[model samples]
Target: MLPKSYFDIFLVILLVPILNLFVYLHNSFSTSLSYLGLPYFIEPDITVDADHVSSSSSPATRRCNIPLSALLLRELLPVVKFSNLVDPPNSCSVCFKDFETEDEIWRLTNCRHIFHRSCLNCWMGYDQKTCPLCRLSLVPHDKEEMYNERLWRLCNNCQL
Candidate 1:
């Protein structure tokens, strides 16, 4: 019969590598699962009808001019600043007038979105709430109404 001490040594030697292998596999599986769990936004290879395109496509593809309320919100959010606005050689979205150094403008903090101050002001005339590019909603001082407004905008934008 094998001595008890020899049996114990053999068991330890055999189990140690197996335990290490199990631990290694567990760590590898956890890393792979984490990667798999991440949200991956990928554009589908198939094309859809033009009508659906506006609703389904990303904000970068949206045809409707940026809303005004979104532009005005810049004054309130620390994310946006007045100095961030720049003079552009491009055309003004509101007047369809070309940009001149004299013309006022603002850039979106998240995406560096540039727009003529007038264009954004005209948009604000209606609602005046979020950033046009990133679409980050601003908190309105009047609680209930602003919250509802923010929720609606988020739903609409997120669906697209």
Candidate 2:
């Protein structure tokens, strides 16, 4: 039989990558949970006894019923020419579909990145509530719809 040291070395070589993979997965899961705004540790209120179990209702048991009206708060408009823009974008960044002259578009008020109205609507409704390009929060801070014209000017200056 092989020496004990040889077996130990072989086991170490096989286990290191597996341990690293677990650590990576745990970290990635924690990061995603943070992005979703969920608490890392949730304390359960239910307790089990030898005879019976007692349970108390908590906010976690309730279903989240976000309304469609909430998602429609973002502004939708036609592509327009601003003094800051040398040339306007012709395509939707999310779906990679070309925009037509009369196509409706959604312009994020914060980052000023634009997308097709339908594409942005679907994206914000289901996938992510952030700008696909810069990962900025799409939710407006106030009820007022304020456009950041400086971003457009900066993009024009950079020729991007």
Candidate 3:
């Protein structure tokens, strides 16, 4: 039988290449994802718990420039069911998804650019105030102040 020292050396020799391959592949994958503007290490999905008042404050949905999403979409540019005539032509600018019949659609008033309802929600969740395609103000001129105020209040969590 081989000595204990020989067995340990053999084991280390076998493991060294495996560990090297792991590190090399990890770095290669991270490099490829970086080119696509994706994070090398992705955070696990975070779900809101009972402790949090809303999902907006949750880490998963936390955005640097948090806007009043509900107010903007629900009260300002309301979602409407997509129909051939009523909806705009072409795919959703935000998510690049095709608009289908019965899909909920949100159309910006100023530029009339259309997007999927959920796509718009996701965009607004990032606190983007302009159209994703044309970079036009999403809110109407008369409601700009009110939208900003709501955004500030919700982001700060204080009445203004």
Candidate 4:
């Protein structure tokens, strides 16, 4: 019943907002999904940005090539019984949960900082290898050599 121009105007008014809303929602969902993945990484020790970032802007540091074998790292972090702790914290730093006698904890050798085993393993699952409290290397300085040697020998990984 409406004139063609009226119909055209009505469709333009309706469809433009719908299209914009669709795009906005799609981007929002994509952003939210991307946001969900960000929390897993506490902080990576190293990052490489190529093509866009020029060498002049950033200092080039030699790669550490640190071995991060989960099995070997676990051996370095000895599990401690809560009741046996010489001076245990009341709660875990990562989860902020109270420690119980039954709860097992892992000690970071370098810093002597302790965390709930589950919390520490979850942190390690994110490829973190630092004491959560002290920000010190989880791998002891002396043991780093042995760790690298064992990893390379066992895994036969090439540096290049």
lDDT values of the candidates? 0.51, 0.54, 0.66, 0.67
Q: 39-121 in candidate 2: lDDT tens per residue?
A: 34332332212121112221233223222222233432333433233365867899998777666676777788878777776
Per-residue alpha-carbon lDDT of candidate 3 for residues 14-69, written as tens digits (9 for 90 to 100):
99999999999888887887687654244333222222233244333322233445
Task: Please name the candidate that would achieve the greatest TM-score relative to the true structure.
Answer: 4
**Could you give candidate 4's per-residue lDDT for residues 81-148 as a string of tens digits?**
99998877899999999999988898777777778988987777677777878889877787898777
The count of residue-pair clashes in candidate 4 stands at: 0
> After aligning candidate 3 to the native by TM-score, how far in Å is the CA of 149 from where it should be?
3.4
Residue 100 lDDT, candidate 2, scale 0-100: 72
Ranking by lDDT: 4, 3, 2, 1
* Per-prediction TM-score: 0.31, 0.39, 0.50, 0.53
User: How far is each candidate from the true structure, as Cα RMSD in Å?
Assistant: 14.0, 16.1, 10.2, 11.9
Top candidate on lDDT is 4
Candidate 1 deviant stretches above 4 angstroms: 1-74, 77-89, 131-160
Those runs of model 2 whose alpha carbons end farther than 4 Å from true positions after fitting are 1-72, 75-86, 144-160
